[model samples]
Structure formats: structure tokens, C-alpha cells
Target: MTDSQDHFDVLIVGAGMSGIDAAYHLSRTLPDMRFAMLDSKDSFGGTWHTHRFPGIRSDSDLYTFGFEWKPWTGVPIATADEILRYLDEALDENDLRRHIRFGQTVRAARWNSGTNLWTVTVERGVETVTLTCRFLWMCSGYYRHTQGYQPDWPGMGDFTGQIVHPQHWPQDLDHTGKRVVVIGSGATAATLIPAMAETAAHVTMLQRSPTYYYPRPKRDELATTLQALDIPQDWVHEIMRRKFLQDGKTMVRRSREEPQAVAAELIGAAQAYLGPDYDVATHFTPSYRPWRQRVAMVPDGDLFVAIRSGQASVVTDTIKRITATGIELDSGQVLEADIIVTATGLTLSALGDVAFQVDGAPVDLTQSWTHRGVMLTGLPNLAMVFGYLRTSWTMRADLVSDYVCRLLAHMQDRGAASVTPALRDTDRDMPVRPWIDPENFNAGYILRALDVMPRQGDRQPWLMTQDYFDDRITLPAANLEDGTLVYR
Candidate 1:
């Protein structure tokens, strides 16, 4: 690979699903435009490559997670390795290998408004290099290479037991014969508890607040049975995909309309499955609406059964402080533990903490509102691609990539210098809150970029249209010169 510094019409940071999708689209649609994709790691799959926690699998099915052009061939909910392979194959098929600069971490990007270009600084190995580009599309997914969010508990320093964070799971850390207490009831915690129960002496999931958990069928037996009855694999996938969308959307809508009813019904189902002794209200009832935060999907209520069988337990209490022996609750109860897994939550950042500048002035992302959650407001010749949390993130990301292609073509045809979002009065335009886990700002990643991110409005696109069928018409085919977008 040539190490000589080069210039490109567009520069993309992070070669994750979003970056890869953007690069592929840019390469195909704007073949004449020079472009480069960078990754801090030496691999293409960003999160998939980095996150190797036990039983880690995508929350969404693959039909939505995969690219429109590239269909998913593996299991519906793919493993990390399978997802990585699919990403690699996508890059290979699209001939994007040469365009990606791996092991290069972007330090800062300054936009020169006068020159109408961005000067990007990247650290590769021991040397720092600079790249100039006409446009910068930040595809760096939320978290940077910084360590995961680990809270400074009161007695963390005194605890002699092995503490593990899902982010940096030590390969040598042994869980055998250990009584583990996994903190946080998010997806990671749900995944960890059952897996650890199989080997550990006991596993307890401690949560300050209750979470909504749904039992999702793992194999889609009906779809499989249909396939055996002579249904084509593609047909099976499409049927199952539609069914999932219908059911998911219905639950989300009903949950918002009648929170208490939905909560009660869910609790009833859980109690029926787990049998009475478990405190379903305290451990399963969330204070927020059903879809306020993402609901963890447990396959076949496996988590509930794990707790029912005495292999695992769920404790609903505020951690008053951390003790050397165990986590102390506000009620003064301390459950001893041999291991602690702080599956607490993650901290999210915009552009993966990569700096941005418009002309000479530094871009204060907080001052700007997101333009359909894809591009920053008032930024010209730039766009970002982030996936959805409710549905498959990749589905929205892939559509955004295609839209960027169409947008690039529109700009080229009209000889436009730049495109930016036209800010409107807050009263007229509704606010949008991103559909992410609502952990404390300091405790997780979402804190850094929350102010900058648009708040979800009560309306359609302004509110994250978690549905793909709606976004297809709105994003890919929608008029580019809509009043919200301005071309320079």
C-alpha cells in the first residue's frame, strides 16, 4: 500500500457498517470523486470486530441489518464472527479494500470555510499525517477507542474479586465456581446473566430500575417449518421479516398509548412463566414507557427460567455504595460476589469524538440540531450515517448511504458547492430525542452528544420513523431541495 499522503474529494472515518455502506455507495455513484475510509483498528467491522463479549449477538434480525444490495445468507441473528465475515465479503465484493486506511485514528478535523474543505489529522502508528478533503462524512460510530464506561464505586478499590467489563472482557478471566453479580438490566446484562449461570456458582442481575423484557423466538420455527414445506428461503425471510415488523410496531405503538396496561400485561406474562415467588413488579416494571428505552429481548424467556431455577436472580435496589465483598444496596443489604460484571451501560459520542470544523470556526455540535439524524444542521458538503436503535440500525444506515449517493448526484448535476440543513424555529420544528438507552450522562456515552442530537418530536420523520417502509419513500426518494435542506 502506498504511504504517500494523498487528497480526496471525500474522507470518511471509521469503516464500520455505516462507513462501509457510505464508502461503497460513494465509490459506485461518484466514481470520479476521490475518497478514503479510515479505521482506528486494523479491521473493517467496527463494533462487531471490537465487541467479543460472551453470547453477543445483534438485537435485530439480519434482513434489516444487512445492505439492500447485499443480502444476508447466514442465520437470522448472526454471531459476531458471521457478521464480521459478511462485512468483509461486502467490502471485498465492492472493491473497497484499497480505499480503506486501517490502523489510522483521526485526531481532529478542521473545516476551512474560506477554502470550502476540511483539513483532517490522523494518527497512524508513531507518525501523524494530514489529509485534505473537499467533504467530510463522519461514519465513526458513537464510541471512540476510549475505554468503556466504568463507574467509580465506593469500594471498587477495596474489592479483591475479579471485575470484568463487557467492553474489555479479559481472555484469561475465569468465572468457574464464582458467584457473580452482573449490574445493569440492559441487553448486555440480559445476555451475560444466563450465559454466566451455566458455569458460575450463581449469577444475580442487579438493577436500580426495572426493564421491559420480551421473549423472542430464536429459530423462527414457523418460518423454518414453511421452508421445509417447500417455501423458498427468500420467501421465508420476507414473511418472517414482515411478521416481525408488524408485531414490533404494534407493541411499540400500544406501549406508548397505554403504558400502564402494557406494563401490567407484560408483568402478568412474566409471572405466569416464572411462577409467583419472583417480585415481578419490582424487578420487571420500568418507570418509563415501554419504548422509552430499548426493551431487552430474551429468547424464550430463558432469562426468566434461569432466575426461576435458582441459577440466577434479579435484585431491584439502588446501589448505595460498593463494598469489598459485594454491592451494598440502599436498604443495607450486601450480596457477596466472587466476580462483578459492570454491564452498566455505554457512553455515546458524536463522530466518535472526532473534531469537526466549518471553515476556520470550530463546530459546536450542541448548537446544531441533527438533520433527520443523518447530517448535522447548517453543515455544508457533509453528512453522517448512523443506524437506528428501535429497528435494525443497518437498515436505516444503508438507506442513508443510498440517499447520500442520490444527494451527491444532485449536487454534481447542479454544480452546487455545498448542502446544509436550514434551521427553523424550535416552535415550528419539533425536537427529537434519539432512541438510545437513557443512562446518566456521566455514566454512559449518550451524554456527550445528547444536546447536539435532535429530540424526537410527536410527528413522523421528525420523530425517528423506526419503520423502514416509511423511510424508504422519505429518505431515498424524497425531494432533496425540501425547505429543510439548502444547497449552496
Candidate 2:
């Protein structure tokens, strides 16, 4: 434990997108800082590495999804392989590979106020190791990688066909010429249906309710045009990222300001893709307004194309039970299939479900309040790297990494050992709200984890929001001596 290998200036958990970005910023802004990036997987790319589902791709465009400092030269919506390659290059180009340890999973982190250090227990293969760090950066993603969420249906065990979850797709289970039924209507289902339809005999999307879908070409015209003109990748990345952000901002604003109009436009887009005679209302139109949960992307209108070709179809009905052969709907209709893929959703895991302690007491994040959505109240030298729910997650990750570096430098300037967020006496009466506003964005994973997440206050720095535009302004100009953050 006394060896230099056991100690670091900072320990960044999860060597995925955010972890690599944090390491890059630390190397550039805090060059002398000794840091390490750790991940449970055998390699980088958290979700991408774990999800081997066919035709797996990003829901958001890669322009903004890529690191702010790095440029993405691939299609707007990139595949899992493309993203993994990009992450690999980010590590190699920034010399961040040396700072990363693969197959190292953090088990628990205990904070010591006396020495202002955190002793972390890690599971590395067959060995248990202990490491100490002055600061802990949580870059691990929000969902559980080992298991995906699937509802227990009345007869799931009775189904004769192969039931599979997209999170753990089997390598040997080929869907070629198979009668496949994908349960769910989110991004994963949208992606799987189209890909499976290409080879499967026929694919049917069974959904309890419809989700809003936005259509866009696979390749971005502007990025392609600029690339064709021999423009530099960095400039293309900057311009495209800004362009996408502005357009997304306008759309988000319109959804809030003019919900009905936005909803109609979204529904109409589906009508245009599927033919005028097609019934968009029964299967494509959602009862809620646009962006209520998430408007999944239908890249190249593939989902509709599959529908048009009769290779795929949608069934809007509640499942009465999963019979031995297929699913029985509430309408007394049963769907028969050779394979059933459950693209239900993901399960949220706080701090990768790692146990934590502070000052010899078990740390319960549900009792803590988020300080600007990064640092938690009463947690010294620990900050999380959560991202935007509506926008590309990397957009917020970049901003947070910058702010963390700035805060670290500020603490160094004052010769302080630790900084923690604490509510002032005047803040005692502030009402607490859910971690995320359900009215704005209510993703199932976030809602399910509400009881386990930190509370938000009614005022500044305490009222954590998903508004990226407001955050872009306030996070950089955040006040250090605002009395909300206590330094020791």
C-alpha cells in the first residue's frame, strides 16, 4: 500500500467515453497530476463493448457524441464498431493508453476525512487490490452492463422459442430466415427490427405503446460536403457539432413551446415515410407529446422501409401472456415466432452499484443532494460524471471535465486538501424534488432509479437540470467562493 503504484492524484472509474475524455483533460490541463482510468470490461467502450446486438448504433449523432477535443470522421449515427475504433484512437493519439487499466472493477470506495484520501477496493481478475487517490472521478455509465431489464411476463418461461435480450445477444443465435418478434419500441428495438428484417423471414414489433420517431439520413450532408472539400477533421467536427447542437436546441425549444405542433410534425414525418394510406396513428403515433421520453432515431428511415416492404410489421397491443409458442395479446391475438428478442430497456445502477462509505459510515446517495449535478453533498473529493438525458451525453461530459480540472487547480492554489458541497443555513427550508423532472424527460431507467438518486433543490447549483444551454453558461462561470462549497 505504501508503493507509488497504489497511490494516484486522481482515479477515474470507467474507461469508456467520459473516462478517456477526463484523462485527456487531466493530461492537458493538469500535466503533473498522476491519474489512472479503470474499466470492468477487458477493453474500453462501456456500452459499445458490452452490447453485441446486430446493427447496434448510437442514438445520437456522432458529431457531438465524439469528444469535443477530438473530431469524428464517420457517419453521423455510427455503429458500435466505429465508436470503439474512435475510442481506441482517442487513447492512442492522446497517449492515454498508459493511464488505462482494463479488466479492473471498483468494488467499494471509503473516504477518510482525517487524511482527505479515498481508499478504493478493486477486483482485478483473481486478485483483490487496494488503491488510494486524492480524488475520485465517476465516469462509469448509468446502466448495468451485466444484465438488462426485462419484465417477468406471465408465461415467459413457457415460451418455446429462443428468448434473447439485446444487452446479451448470443453470438451463435442467427436469425436468418427465422420468424422473429422484437418486444419494445425504443432505439434498440428500432435498430434490431430493421437489421433482423433483412435476414429474418419476418419481424414484428410488439409494443404496449408507441414512441415518437425522427427520420434522418445515415450520412450528414454538411459533414460529407465538407469532407469532400478536403476540410480538416477538427474543423468539421467543430462546425458539425455546433450545427447539430443549434438545431437540437431549436427542436427542443419547439417541443416545449409548441408541443402540439411538434407532435404533429413528428407524426406527419412517419406518415410521409410509410405512405399516405398507412395508419400512422395506431402504431406510429404516441399519445404523449414529442420528446416526452425520447424521440428515437430511424436512420435512413429503415424502420419504415422495412414496414413498406412487408418484411416487418408493428402490433400495438398489451401482452396478455407469453404462451408456449408465442405471445397472447389483450385483443386475443397471438404472435408466433421462432425467436423473441426483448429490447425492453436498461437498468440503472448508481456508481456501478459499488458500495461506498464516508467517515466510517455507509454512504447513501439517496440522502445526498447533487451540487450542480456533479459533486454530491457531504462527499469530499468525489464527483460523478453524469450526462444530459436529451442531448448527446458527451456534450455535458466535456463541460464537466473542464470544470473539474478548474476546480482542482483552484483548490491547489488555496493549498486545500478537500472540497465538499454543503447546504447553507438559509437553504434548510428549500423543498426537495426528484433528480429529474418527469414532465420534461421521463426515461424509464431514470424514473426507476429516482428513489436511489440525489435530490434537487429549488435554487441555483442545487436545482440540477437537463438544460445543456443553461449549463453551458453557468458551469464555466460557476462561483467558487459561493459558500455552497466548503473547502478544508
Candidate 3:
């Protein structure tokens, strides 16, 4: 990559799904606008490209997870390789690869009101390059790609075998016929247990507490039925997307309104897979309500099948420490292992932890309020793609892409150089809250990063409502003439 300073109408940070969607929208909607996409990694597919654990797959169904514009003909649940292939195809079909500047990390962005441009400093290897853009799009995502979150347990150095975090998986790792102990109950752990059980001597999934596992078929019945009828791929995609969205909205609403009923259905499903003999209450039932944390999807009940086959087992107990041989349980049980896989959650950063300045003053993101969970209050000409937690992530990405394009077109028509979200007289006394409400959803990763993320105001435009059903209707219908978004 060259070190020369360049200017663009829009600068998109990150070449992942969000960035690619934004770029695609920009290309389609504003064909004459100059734009560039950057990713710290050498290639696209942010999480898909980076996470290389065994049987790494989408926790959410691909119909909702896949981009709305692109038709996904693959199974509902897809592997990382499959997703990468899909993403790669999207890039190639749209001629998007040429617009991406890989291996460049956005270091800092300074917004100057005088010039109405963002002077972005990016680094590639040892060379620092400067670029400016009229509008900055933060599609970098929230997850820290550099490392996964691994808790520091005592005697970790004493362990004789390889201890790997799923995020930074070793390419040459061979766990065949080896005793593996995976320390997690989330999606990664669920995916790995069955995958490793195929070759490993045995795999034990150790969790401090249980997470709800929702077993679903790999293929969507509707999609398969439509394909059998020889319906067009685009029509099938839209039909499935709408069906899933409506179903998901109803489920989420029910999860909120009838927590116990939703929880019972999930537990009953697990019991059906594990059989009546298995301790479903101890290992399958979550203490919290459904959707409090993302329910891990087990395609075809693979994990339960592995457990039922006696090739794999689940141990719900607190870890005391790591010994030379295996993990020591607080219950005085010692499980030996040849390999320990930390299927721990992600290390997140709000807006990729990049330094931002507004006309020279450093922006304090934690102090600012999120505007529709897409743009930030007091941040001019900037929007970050923070996707849905309960639903498939790509759904929110697609919506935000359309919203951004619409916003840009509105600004152009109004001859506006910059737009910022400012609190009006009506919003002066509005109460503030955390990025995510703990009562509604309290995942460990989100709780850990509360102080590092932006706050949310109590009202409509100021709140970062994670509801996709509401956002889909509200985002596009948002009035540009509204007093909240100040145009200059």
C-alpha cells in the first residue's frame, strides 16, 4: 500500500461484512462518490477470516445472517469456510476487492469543522499514511481481533499440553485421538465438542454454568420447499428472510413477556435430545431467562448427540485452578486432558478503540450517547455499525447500510457539509443508561465493556434499542428534517 495522502467522499474502516455491505450500498446508491475500505487483516471476513477453531460455524441461521442483497443458497447453518466463500463471491460479483486496502489499521481520525473532513491516520507495517474523507464509517466491528478473552487461572503455566483460545487457533494443531477439555458453554464450545469428538479420544465441555442450547436443523424447511418448487433464488431469500425476521421478533417478544414459558420450551427441547436419564436441569437449563444471553444454536443437536454417544460429556462446575495434568474443579473433581481449548468470549472495543478527535479535542466515547445505536451524539459525520445481539448480526448491518446511504443522500440534497446529533430542549433532562440494559441482556462480554462503550439516553432517537423489528421500520422512516440531527 502507498503512503501518499488521499481524500475520499467516504472512508469505511474494516472490510468485514459490515464494511462490505456499506461499500456495496455506497456503490449502488451513490455511484459517483469516491470511497475506500480498510481492514487491519490482509483479507476480508472479519470474524470468519480470523476465527479458525475446529468446526467454526455461524451460531445464527444464514438466512438472516447473510446479506439481504445476496441470495444464500447454502444451508441455514454454515461453516466459516462456507461463509468466507459467500463473502468472497459477494466481493467478486460486485468488483469490491479493488476498493479495499488490506493490512491497514486506522490509528486516529481527526474531524475538522473548518475543512468539514476527517483526517485519518492509518498504519501499515512501519509506514504511516494519511487519508481524509468527508464522512467516516466505522465498520471495524466491536470484537478485538488481536486476541480472545481468556481468564487468568492459577497454574496455567504448569499445564503440559497446548492451551489454545478459539480466536487464535493454531493451523497445524492435531488433536486427533487426544483427550480435550473445552472450557465454555457458548457457541464455540458447542461447535467444537462435536467436531473434535469425531477424531479425539474424548472431549469434555466444562462450564461454570449452563447456557441455553437451541437445536435446529441445518436446512430451513421453507427454503427447501421453495427450492423444490423451482422458485427464483432471490425470491426464496427474501421470503425466508421475512419469515425468520417475523418469527424471531415474535420469539424475542415472547422471551421478554413470557420468560418462563420460553425457557421451558428450550429446556424441553434439550431434554428430548439428551433423553430423560441425562441431568438436563444441571447442564441444559440456564439460570437466566431466554435471550438474556445469546442461545447457542446446535445444528441437528450435534453436541447432544456427541454426549449421548458417550464420546463427549458436559461438566457444570466452577474451576478451582489449572494443574499440570488437567483442570481442578471446585467440586474436587480432576479431569485430565491432552489439550485445553478456551472457548471463551471476545475482547471487545467500542469503535475498534481508535483515537478520535473533533477539531483537535480527543473524543471521549464513554461520555457520549448513541444515536439509534448507529451514530453517536456529538460526533459529526460518523456512524458505527453495531449489529444486533439477539438476532443475526448481518440483518442489522444491512439495515444500517441502507440507513447510511439514505442519510448521505439527504445531506447532499440539503447541501450539508456535516451533521451531528445534539440533545434538544426536550432531551435535556432525559436519563442515561448503559449501552445494554442488564435486566434485558447481561452477557459477560457486554458487562465487561460497559465503561468502555457509549451510553444510551432514555428516549427514542437517543436510545440504542437492539430491537431489529423496531429498527427496520424506524431507521428508514427517520425524518432528516427532525431537530435531533443538526445539519451544517
The candidate, 1 or 3, that scores higher on lDDT is 3
- The weakest ten consecutive residues by lDDT in model 2 span 440-449
Q: CA lDDT of 318 in candidate 2?
A: 93
Candidate 1 global TM-score: 0.89
lDDT of 3 by residue, 285-360 (tens): 8889899999889999999999999999999998999999899999999999999999989998989979999988
- Which 10-residue window in model 3 sums to the lowest lDDT? 1-10
- List model 1 lDDT by residue over 1-488, tens digit each: 22336677888887888898888888888898889898899788888877777777777777667776676655566677888888889888989989999999898887766666677899999999888887788888766445777788887877878788888888787888899999988888888888789889999998888877777667777666766787666666666666767777788778778878887877787887789876787788777777667777777777888999999998888887777888889988898998999987776666677777676677776556566667766567777776766777777887888877888888889987777876545426465455433631123345544665544444433444556667877787677776667776
> How far out, in Å, is residue 308 in model 1?
2.0
Q: Give the per-residue lDDT digits (tens) of candidate 2, residues 1-488.
A: 45798899999999988898899999999999999998999989998999999899999999989998888998999999999999989889999999989889899999999889999999999999999999999999888898899999999999888999999999999899999999999999999999999999999999999999999999888888999999888999999999999999999999989999999998998999899999898998788878778889989999999999999999999989999988999999999988999999999888788889989999888889899998999789887888988899999899999999999999999999999999999998989888898887887777888898888999988977888898999999999899999999
lDDT of 1: 0.76
Q: What is the alpha-carbon lDDT of model 3 when measured against the actual structure?
A: 0.92
Name the 10 consecutive residues with the lowest summed lDDT in model 1: 435-444
TM-score of each: 0.89, 0.98, 0.98
Colliding pairs, model 3: none
